[model samples]
Target: MQPIVHPVVGYVCYAVYARWADGTPPASSPAAVAVVAATLPDLLDQPLYHAGITPVGRTIGHSLLFAVPLVALVWLVARRRGQSRLAVAFAIGYGSHIAADVPWHVLAGDYHELGFLLWPVTPMPAYSGVKTLGTVGGLEVTTLWLEAVIFVGGVALWWADGRPGLDLLGRRFDL
Candidate 1:
């Protein structure tokens, strides 16, 4: 899967979370948290990996080591503070990122890579620091099936996000 696909997955998960849990659209503060949490792993992982701080993009940041405890902590705090919905919304997006990434490598028979999902408790292999984001630029040519899924999910997200969250520009970035 590509990087763009991750966030699209996040958005789709946001919609799913709303429909299944909240009955409200994934919007307002929760939507804001979801969007950021979705992309956070890559945002923190890449530059660190690129700079040789870690051997792989899947580090503590991408691991259950980080996510489980963080989400638990957030859930606990949110419940105490009466913000459980926000915590659940963020967890949906954050967890969906890892869920989506796991299959992308697993289907290719990279079993050892699975440890990255639970890291520290499981060992990690070196990830050659190479940029993969460029792969997304050739969307139509390289990843026809994946791109199609992204397109459909994007359309769904547009509808589910209440269809002009795009007015963010005119609304002066309400998100």
Candidate 2:
């Protein structure tokens, strides 16, 4: 998927994470901090992809092994803060990150292999081939639409969660 779409998806997952936290701590809370941290690994791709210095699959950020350890570390930190919720929030975000990417991976294989979805648990790397999201037409249409659906669905679910104010992106400040 495009880097532009990736962040949007991350924000969608952020909304999910925030909803799971029920606004008691806010998205800026320790819980949200872990969620944001989980998204950090993807930020690396922005520079690498734009610079054209790195192949898509060459980055370790795409590795589940790399991410799980980082997630655990953040979870541990949140635990120390007496906030297990934060750790769980991070896990949700991280899982969302992977879940959001699956469609794209299914459509098009990364520059190299598919990616380390199974990672340390299983070394079997899958191949998406070049037919799925590889073509410009497919990616533009499918990814954008998928992002829209996830974004809307996440917001709706958050609303359904019965939280009072819409704290998304600090929008509460507008009121």
Which is the leading candidate under lDDT?
A: 1
lDDT of 2 by residue, 109-153 (tens): 443344456443434344343233334644445455665676567
List residue ranges in candidate 2 displaced over 4 A.
Answer: 1-31, 34-38, 107-113, 116-141, 158-175
Whole-model lDDT for model 1 versus the true structure?
Answer: 0.71
lDDT of each: 0.71, 0.54
| Reference-based lDDT, residue 98, model 2 | 61
The model with the greatest TM-score is: 1
- Write the residue-wise lDDT of candidate 1 on 1-175 in tens digits: 5667676677777777777876866665676667667888888888988999887777877898899998888889988999987788789878888887775445455667677788778877864222223244565333436556786877676576675334554477665
Per-prediction TM-score to the true structure, in the order listed:
0.76, 0.58
lDDT of 1 at 10: 73
Off by over 4 Å in 1: 126-144, 164-175
